[model samples]
Target: MRGPVRWVLWDVKDTLLKVRRSVGEQYCSEASRLGLELPPSQVEAAFKQAYRRQSKLYPNYGTAQGLGGHRWWVAVVKDTFSQCGVKDGATLEKLSYNLYHNFKNAENWEVFPDSERTLRSCTDMGLKLGVVSNFDNRLEGILRACGLLSHFSFLVTSEGAKVAKPDAAIFHQALQRCGDPASSVAHVGDHYVNDYLTARSLGLLGLLLDREGSTLHLDDVPARHRLSSLDELPALLQKRAEGG
Candidate 1:
């Protein structure tokens, strides 16, 4: 473990927590209450579409922080409703933001089944842990609420780092906090280019958790491991450590 990976850095959304339901669920429900009459499924679909639109916004806006981070999600909800034939923009936006505020107070975030067990095992193995995420400042509190704050000794967020994935500085900041080497620390994520390849570029181990193959940039990098499931992680890491 002498590489940039003496510590383990995790991504939040899509890595540990699955966000099975929309993060905007409560707000979307409220939108329906305001005569939007939008089906839950339609709202969910619109949310996903709007979420992906942030990729375009970031480059043009030079926004290093995640575009869909709270404020962006507010606009996303507004735009989504507008596109889906909702007439009252101002009221819906307010409702959306109000719902998002409730999320800020929420502690029980849904997580993948293997998430807690995996992090616990990593801690038990004596590895230092941290998070490098394209997240809002609320990430720490959210993880803390989910009973996960104790696992990570540190976290570097886009809000704190002022840059998102593919930026080596963010990862470096995480390593600096953990007092570890990037070469020894394996970065695990579901994203191909943003997380795994970025780790590879920094001489750290890159582990890809490609459940749905949503990693469009997958072919662009030579990842150290391609994991189709989180269940395979512990064994694979043990093998890598033992030179298997």
Candidate 2:
């Protein structure tokens, strides 16, 4: 189901933008720049493994239970390089930290043409916009780099939310920050269960931003709107806003 879309929350990585070339390419280049002699595949694999473990712990972060994703990412970066024989010194740590930290905001990252066009159209149409993403890096930096920051008045990261996606708390924070109820907000993102189901479960209108999945989800979010591209959003919101 669709409605007036008082607010639209977006996902950052695959939905709004993609990395330039590939992780292998950047890992190799960045590693060489830091004077590391490790192979690209090996360094990239370790880095990825570390990131996964770190991002999984956001829910327990400020409480007595868990460490948040950023610490997880830093540890992963540190260990990955240390295992490759790089010592845990300031230079090595800074190289790993800032290289991965700056990856999203770097000039070479690519935003889908349709994404830029749609975001512009939506903002022009006067719809409130914000971002709710599970990220290690500050999302605002990436949004600013993409020239899309002005479109958003609210942007919440896992750091602020204190939990990652699939946890309704983060989405709730985005909604609260945007000054809307879940019923009037829409969440558009790529992942099936993580983004769509989580939003739908909270009674927010959830749309899966994937070209495939014309079929319904086995769990919740089944029958939710499916958008092949963000290009369709302006029209979808237009219809809802006018009660057409």
Quick one: best lDDT, which candidate? 2
Q: Of the candidates shown, which would achieve the greatest TM-score relative to the real structure?
A: 2
lDDT scores of the candidates, listed in order: 0.72, 0.74
Across 60-144, the per-residue lDDT of candidate 2 in tens digits comes to 3322255555565567677667666678598567866776576656575788879888988988988788888877445677778
TM-score of 1: 0.79
What does the lDDT read for residue 130 in candidate 2?
87
